[model samples]
Target: MAATISPSSPNYHASISNTTINNLFDDSLTEIFCKLPCKSLFTCKSVSKRWLTLISNPNFHSLFLTHQHTLFQKTQALGEDLDQPSFILKPYNALVITPNSPSLQLGPLENHLSLSFLGPNFEPTNIVPQLRSVLKFVFACSNGLLVYGNPRPRHRCIYHIRNPLTKDSLELPCALTLCDHAGVLVGFTCDPYYHLETDKTKNAKVSIFSASQRRFRVVRIPAFSDTRSAFDVEVFYSETGKWKNFLVSCPKGFACGFFLTASSVEHEGKLYFMGGGRVLVYDPYENERVASVIELPRGFGEAYRGCLGVSCGTLQLSEFPISPSSAFEAYSGRVWELKHCGKGEETTTTTTTWELVHEFCLPEVVGPGFEELKANESENVKGCSRILAFHPYVRDTVFLKFGDNIICCNLLTRRFKVSKYGGLSLLFYPVIPIVIPWWPTPIPALPL
Candidate 1:
């Protein structure tokens, strides 16, 4: 009976164990698959039925996420050489038409899609289809997720919450109340406690799903006040699937003009909005109805453009110095960190003070000035280097726009690198890679 095996029979090869990945034990297979990047794991899913099942298993995802966290912990303990933060750049533009005559026949401009990232390796990975037809513009980034919406008017617009790493996107129905209102501003925040509630080991690696439903909070506020220094605000809660409305009043005499592209930063559960001369702070989660405004630290002029961000558990301001400089670039980088002068959670926003933390010149950061800009400084003023974005999490890092290049600088380390993304209306956000792919079991239905 032992000698009766035939080459044509499927069982004939069963006794001869093949040492391929598919034949490895479940525990061994998970260890190898978990090491691959999100995109690579997507590719490996198609290798075989066994692999697809194992990779798609809930248990596998939990283990992979645990492993990623462990690696991150180790990197953090080891310091700079290992756990440096990462960044991603995405460009956007609006569809403009004649203000007076809607039918003037000025067609839409060509849209360009360019995405690049600077990670621990410093090498940029080019993702495909840089131009996504559905992605009109990105409004905010919370954790590793992004909230993007269509360029169409409020009535016709739709918003999408996406995880760029997993390529899982959720298209949400338009929030007419939030979108239809003029001067409305949108912001996103990632719940720090989101992971604790959702970290069950049963269904971790479900593969394709948006991160929004799992752990994201989106808030909407009016930029300008109908009343003096006060605005109405609304919040979208993922857990309950509802929007909550509230009001925020800025300190007396504080005036802010939020541009179409102005962005807000969320730090320690509070949102900081940049105004003409002060930073408006909104504590959405707190019971407070009024916002507290902080004036620019003394010696920091209000004439120049400024951006707000949170880094190292403190709020920061990065100002583009409009002061006269001999360099061809009109603006030099200026950074400041907000320090709390008083204690207690009640006085956190109102009692904070700012201190100059870092500053760098364009020429020193970007190496050499562009050839054309060098020819004539005043002539190239329109295209002068400017601060584009901040490292949302880290205050010391800032992104600069010098002509066509996007420069990334780490103020603490004094290290700068020019980004490889090329597109109009450019912006960037930072992300830390992990292998947890969350796929919602009951597909979320879109509003009609």
Candidate 2:
């Protein structure tokens, strides 16, 4: 753990005394050590109790997160990991996305992030007591942490906030809900900045925003029947370890099934629920009303579907033109980019701006058992074609659920491949795609 050069600089051979290392001020050591790789930091801990205390401190984690958001994320190449792939920033990211974020969509992350909580091999029975069920689906994901829930009916399941990389997890209290899972819209996000306490909105009460600002939130909008009507929303703050109810309203015009079976993703500092027809936005830091809503560029009719994702620091959406199961008949998909439009359109409820990024088709497959699958499609059975998630790195590729198998299709390559993770009676839920860092984020222990 001692990071000392021999007495002769490069040619030195004498170990530096622990006394000399401990002589440095805590701040000085922190400023220097935070820049080291996570593995090196861990090894440095055995040097002394002072090193252990410095590395384990919350303040030090905050500092480490800042460094990752800036220089560390940039130096990492796309589709490649560092020599030491054991560095991940804490969950309290403050809207600081770097340019090379596309790397998050590496080939295997979508499957791993979706199934990591079941234990090392993504087995269904590999669950913690707190994670009661065999894992229904990921509620929300930010940075590298996931809010996974059980498959109990009526949304009556427990949620566990877990960092698979670090193997750190926190069990949240039962959800405060007046409706079922289909009736609710859930999102997970952590404090973005360190100074959010003083950065509260106007002179409003800042109960939800803490000073450490390192806490995460699991927000559930239980009811959304009447448009423009206010309803109770339950939010669980990690800092206080309690669920606080707040009344908020959403933009009008969308129907009830808009957010049906949808999952939330934290983008920038806000939460986005990729609804059936439009995107429902919510900001946890401010306002009793919902944040700006974004309308999709085209229709995602009941047959075809769409999924939202972030890659290369830009908001992207992939819309399937036709169900992949119907590849034998028709095959087409589209990708769109979300961007800010020109100002002066304040009269509009949403600043609608989307550019068609890519349109692709899948190569046809000829094999046995195709006729049986096609027959199921013709009968209009349930779970025909569902888009689970967009590839985190590759924009054109997407993960789709046809029946018992989750297919990873690359629109650009026109290829189809089946994942080894199937044949289970798993719930039909959207896969929560996460771009994991080299090191895993740690779940801070909340006060009991």
Candidate 3:
């Protein structure tokens, strides 16, 4: 009924049809592609424009992250299960970049990369050429960006708001005039209400820095004469770029020592300070108002001092009901939940209840002689021993510091394992081109 097609036309048609088939399965194919090494992943991008797009999409990026996390979990499981214990104490001396977004991969680099560890003796190892030189203490990372602070004298004690994955860093200047004596830099996430005046004119207040500024000016807080007691400080965000501080009363003679620790978490548009066995919530915008204090469980009042050592100011909420409320404290070998609600807010007045959810105590995995250190016993030790929470999607993982040794705990399973070697700190890098389940996959499904 129609003109016969030529042999050459049929061959061309078949080639086009094959490509369409590949495009249809691009998401699945990209997952397979991300498993390859970073260099190899780059090379595979040239296979077709469709492949390139699939690799770059944020959805596909999430797939890669998930794969990487899966691989890491698998590796850790294998190390634990191995009978011969072929593990090597290789030092990973590089910047640890953890992304806030479960799907977004940092930089153009793959999810995981290897770096030379400098060791516990503070010896300098051969530098990895591809990695950055600036060593930053990264606390919390989100949306492809990281919240880091440099404690060195050379860097002027500034916080580097950066995206290591993208190699983009922003230097946020210290808000305090006395940067040298600034107890600690606490970062909070709060939503400040912004209002405009009448007469059709916009009321501009504090100015935050734009990308062009590179370095943002510090938001000045009113100075206090008492140096012995630490002040509860927080940074609030509004429509404009400015920092507003809200101060809360502290215990007498609590300032000189490390009593108050900053938190990297922003809960319900507010920043929190943990100290004196209490959680004080502050609203940066409402400077005139008093801070709300949430009392800790009775047992935690004394127990917190020992287990809550090494104040990095980073708090991670557990997935399961570790405590009565969704909130729980992570430190040392234990995971504590809010057992009872004390007299405080309207929320607390109604429910003066105590509920036992789950308690994860560190297992005696460190050999027979090591007795489980009580919270009080460990408090006497010196130096920074922090607990870092790594959120890689479904499972919540926590890092514990006991003296120099670092222990990693899988919150989902409540299993604990120690690092191969002891070091000052442990940072998790999300964009180093390694396979982690949280990383984005190569190809993503399109929206219907």
Candidate 4:
């Protein structure tokens, strides 16, 4: 009835029945694969040519993204001990990556094979014989992508845009003109509309991240200008893969000194750069030529250090004044929130105002070494302190640094705790905070 089959025969396994997975339709397969973690989906590509083909399809990516987003909607914030303490500080000195990616793993046959951090456009002049990789100096982060560049001055800088979650790196073409380090400002922003509410299942808010359909822009403003505040700004679009020059001159008298050390925050659909006692607002998506500027609550001078960040869906700025303290011998940083003060929300940047939100002190919870300063009321010499960052999701939590010691203070509770990540470079490599949304962001899933 049946032909005799041997082990070497092509039809030897024909008599065996296929598994349920093999019988699944492409759409059905994708639906199931979407439920699994992203890392597992990547490994599934090795199962068979059919599985690889299904996962590689662009349509499959869209569906998977939507389904993952649905799962996110079902989850609740602050449900666990992690009141979403999910934000991470990405530094320029560290090219931190997950060791779990299959493509990033190094093989003994090829020593030091991975240099994706440097981007594809630039070539390194020298490398250690046994070194495995070279790190980068990260400039900015938006959505889930990162912008880092080559550090060698001789090599200038070839900027690289990276999706840390996907390991996708696009090497941007060299800048037409390198903005000098004196007072240059660089900012990154991703389109929020691409991540708008989709999948008519849940009443979910738009995600703080964009993936699969994400489009971003990298803005580079010219160096310091003492004359008029007008300058030709460069805008890079990921869709066209090109840079277009545009002039932004909204309000004059906008000056920023040592802007390279300042931090920028992106809220709603615009980027807010705080420096020179002013906040420069730029919308890379909608407004083509308008760059609105906002005045700070208090003029920040050399005696004070400032850090800008967003918390509770509003913009919050912290100022660390190395000045005299009215209360305890040791002074605490002052927090201010940008408020819409006028009659209605119709006010622009020029009309908006900042209100003092909270004044926090370093709690003794951080242990010893602070009593001497508090006891020495006359030694009003303010210890070297800095406002590191504000908690992205937390209401009133902010990170501070006193020399090498890192402390996290909650303005609501007036308490403080030392951060594990201390002794970082106090000068060049400032630890920039990148917020991780509830579900898709990597900081929560991956170890720092």
Best by TM-score: 4
Give, for candidate 3, the lowest lDDT window spanning 10 residues.
428-437
For candidate 3, what is the lDDT? 0.37
Q: Scored by Cα lDDT, where does model 4 land?
A: 0.56
- Report the number of backbone clashes for model 4: 0
> Which tens-of-lDDT digit does each residue in 1-448 have in candidate 1?
4387687989868756654655678888887877775556777888888889998876676566555555544544553421242223333331111111111112221211122221222222233233222222566665546666543324434556665544566766456463343344567765531242233676432232235444456776655533356666777666665666766666554444445336667776677666667666777667447787777877765523566665555777777755655553355768888877756676543367778877776666545544544454333234545565555433476766555555566766766765443544332222211111122122233334
lDDT of 1: 0.53
Q: Could you tell me every candidate's TM-score relative to the true structure? A: 0.66, 0.63, 0.49, 0.69
Number of the top lDDT candidate: 4
Q: Which stretches of candidate 1 lie over 4 Å from their true place?
A: 1-19, 45-136, 151-157, 178-182, 192-215, 225-229, 250-256, 302-304, 324-329, 342-350, 366-382, 392-395, 425-448
Residues 137-218 of candidate 3: C-alpha lDDT, one tens digit per residue: 3433333343554333223344545433333445453543332332343443312112112333443222221122122112
lDDT against the true structure, per candidate, is 0.53, 0.56, 0.37, 0.56
Scored against the true structure, residue 332 in model 1 reaches a CA lDDT of 71
Those runs of model 2 whose alpha carbons end farther than 4 Å from true positions after fitting are 1-137, 154-157, 178-183, 192-212, 223-229, 256-261, 321-329, 345-350, 364-387, 391-419, 422-427, 444-448
The C-alpha stretches of model 3 lying farther than 4 A from their native spots are 1-144, 151-157, 173-176, 180-182, 188-239, 245-263, 267-269, 283-290, 301-334, 339-398, 402-404, 410-414, 425-448
Query: How well is each residue in 1-448 modelled by candidate 2, as lDDT tens digits?
Result: 9675656685453334345656778988988886776656767889888888888876776666555545543554433321211111211111111123322323333233334344532234422452323333456778677777654435565678886544568888887654353445668886433321221545421212135437777887653444543556677877788788886665454333424235677877678776436677778767634555677786545412676777556777776545545644244666788878655656553355888877654324313434545454423233444556665545455565555445666555555565333333223334566556534555655777
Per-residue C-alpha lDDT of model 4 across residues 376-436, encoded as one tens digit per residue: 3222223556676776645687766655445556767655555334323433344456542
Error of 4 at 28 (Å): 7.3
- Clash count for each candidate, listed in order shown: 0, 8, 50, 0
